[model samples]
Target: MVMRTLAASLLSIGVIVTSMQVSAANEPIQPIKPVKPENAELVELGKMLFFDPRLSKSGFISCNSCHNLSMGGTDNIKTSIGHKWQQGPINAPTVLNASMNLAQFWDGRAKDLKEQAGGPIANPGEMASTHDMAVKVIKSIPQYQAQFDKAFGSKEVDIDRVTTAIAAFEETLVTPDSRFDKWLEGDKDALTKEELEGYKLFKSSGCTKCHNGPVVGGNSFEKMGVYKPYKTDNPAVGRMEVTGKEDDRFVFKVPTLRNVELTYPYFHDGGAASLEEAVEIMGKLQVNREFNKEEIANIVAFLKTLTGKQPDFKLPILPPSNNSTPKPQPFE
Candidate 1:
């Protein structure tokens, strides 16, 4: 009798283990891996550039101005405040996990972070400084040239090098180890019953069709209003601006939902104010389905579980400006 009981216990344990393995394998979303350390000097240089408002024409706006690290890697506003307090055309996406994106920008115009880094510096609405001027300003700073030598084996600072440093630093801003990742890793208790149910609904409702991957999105371009039109006063033509094709109208790169709870108001236009509203809007516009109150609530709970550990580091202290440093022409 004792032998039979022990055999039965072993069998049950085997079954449970197999079940957990299967459950893990069946999930579409993957956990974000922690960013491995790259060149320390290069990353440090990038960090300084990321924080230095000298990259902007006004000398007051930095990358952190729009993508604030303390506030879930986003500015937490409907639209970003840009040069001369100008409202940006579209809402700013969070910089956290942006390195995982296949392409940068809503239109996917810039091929990678390196390419994207040079854009806002010259964009009239954003940073409003020419790349040539940006380089000249950085070159004027002797300390920056020293740091450049340490990073790139040369003191020669150019726009390409400047963007490369910024991109290198941006790549380090990844968030990992969320509660959902714990659940995905086979810790069955990581999520509440409602949250788990919500995950099921999220998959069944076709949210995972676009939002599948380590970052839980940013994998492909999708039309925003598949089932119906997404009404917005914002005049972004989406990927049509990039491809210049009428068929690509309303198409945009799906944004990451990794830290959705904190990165609101939601959407390219910042139309939806709350997660509940966002979920409902997504369902109706993307999937042509109307989720009830309970469904929206549970889905939101699951989304909250995706808020992972954010990047932690001391703010970089920038080099002091000297007489050679180019003056910021904010008014002119």
Candidate 2:
């Protein structure tokens, strides 16, 4: 009689678990849309510029140097390696799915990808090249001029055109069709039991307040330490620099969870060496809760499901510099 009663209870539990899985299709997190470029030639031109190191004063660093497509669109370092090997102030954010971000940079300085693409090249600590120099170098190359004419209907090379092409290529970097996305699309077997539970906890534990939406986090800005203070040796004032407002201090754009499994070490300071540590730190500081080892593991498993199909394209072959091309000053 006791064995029969135990079997009945187990059967009842199974039904409840199945119901929960079905209901998960109604969750707010949306799937990423696959990219379809409107202008293939323009995108190809942008791809060439993205891979060309001639944009930098040293002719050694390209957009791919920091935001490597092979490594989840980030350099995967504590901070980026800059011109003269200078250390960057903050960790490099992933370029993948970046077009979905409300604003660019940790501080949300640039309004769009086009604006953001121009920043690093002119920054003294980064590529260390003036916009004029970059344009001059590109304009001097006859092959690039022909390609630009094909792309824009004009052979005039300028900073605006350069940045516009780069932005066009970056827009194609969106990733879609992750396991979590498959689950969201009503595939019951897409996520395991633990991942579903983790998703429930992720929403219930107040993580969804900031981490919701299509990209799972890039839509808003939040304080790094809402419940407590965040300690970091890296001295970034966050949005305060952009707004000149005291209240905006320590407030930063919440990074996207998409492909986060590959974009590490985590956080703006890149202090958390592993996803488990990052999750624990966020729970205590951002949500004012502590997660145990099992919970952390489950949450991380769910987070890993955010990894999707990365962009696939052939490596671009940059046009060679002509005799009139300005020389890059590596030391100056």
Candidate 3:
């Protein structure tokens, strides 16, 4: 009887260990922690700059032009429209939760949000403005100068400080408390049966291999077509242009699935117009499997659960330019 009791206790301990392992395997993606900016003054200043088209050579295209907050942090177009209506090569990725990305841009070129902030301003096709000109425009505005002095403890308004303030504002662009986050927090009822099954299928089909993270992606760079080639007419060569490595061709930063439903026209080229089509294509190209209509729908449902609370803030009224301010060269 004593021997039998000891054996039973050992079996019970083994069962508990196995159960714990299964529970751990069920949760791979973590929840996002919403971060607020420590420097409220800097964030407010950045907000003005973000919405101020004066930063652009055309004095029309602002950071909000491509990354519209009302439209899920993207322009919702296949490609962005730039200065003089020059078409952008690749789709504009959403800025929501962008600070969580390993690197900025589809090619993972920019090291951080601050570095990424300067790219479009100088890109001839985008803002069509130089750093020196951008500083001059801001400095000329007396109201802006006062704000800069208060925010930075200096009246100086250089590109570095400008981008730093913008990055600070962007750092607070996180969307937390989604249904998926609730599920991750041990709320079993947060997700439906169908959604749960879809998540299981997603893991079993190896979709989570690349898309597993707090952001459900954006943690690393991955080839657009791992199992097969992705066809696109877009001329951008992905990471190859940055790394100059033949193997880096077609390797782009994996975008986050958070608020994906709102950021339609999927992929770098924005070839897949619908979420269903994007899921089907990803399954075929990345997993080498063709998902049925039901599977696709279920997966899309799971993806929708990633939508979180959007940022809430009042629109900033930009300071008007004075006589010293350089006139915008919209036509020039």
Residue 88, candidate 1: Cα error in Å is 0.7
Off by more than 4 A, model 3:
1-26
Backbone clash pairs for candidate 3 read none
- Which one wins on TM-score? 1
- Give lDDT tens digits, candidate 3, residues 1-332: 99788767867777644433324235667788889678899999988999999999989999999999999999999999999999999999999999999999999999999999999999999999999999999989888889899899988999999999899888888999999888787666789988887888888899888898888899988898888999988877899989999999999999999999999899999999999999999999999989999999899989889899897999899999888888889887
Root-mean-square deviation of every model: 2.5, 5.1, 3.6
As a TM-score, model 3 comes out at: 0.92
Q: Name the weakest run of 10 consecutive residues (lDDT summed) in model 3.
A: 16-25
- lDDT values of the candidates? 0.91, 0.91, 0.90
Model 1 scores worst on lDDT over the 10 consecutive residues at 16-25
lDDT of 2 by residue, 211-292 (tens): 8788898999888899999999989989898999999999999999999999999999999989999999999999989999
- The superposed Cα distance between candidate 2 and the true structure at residue 109, in angstroms, equals 0.4
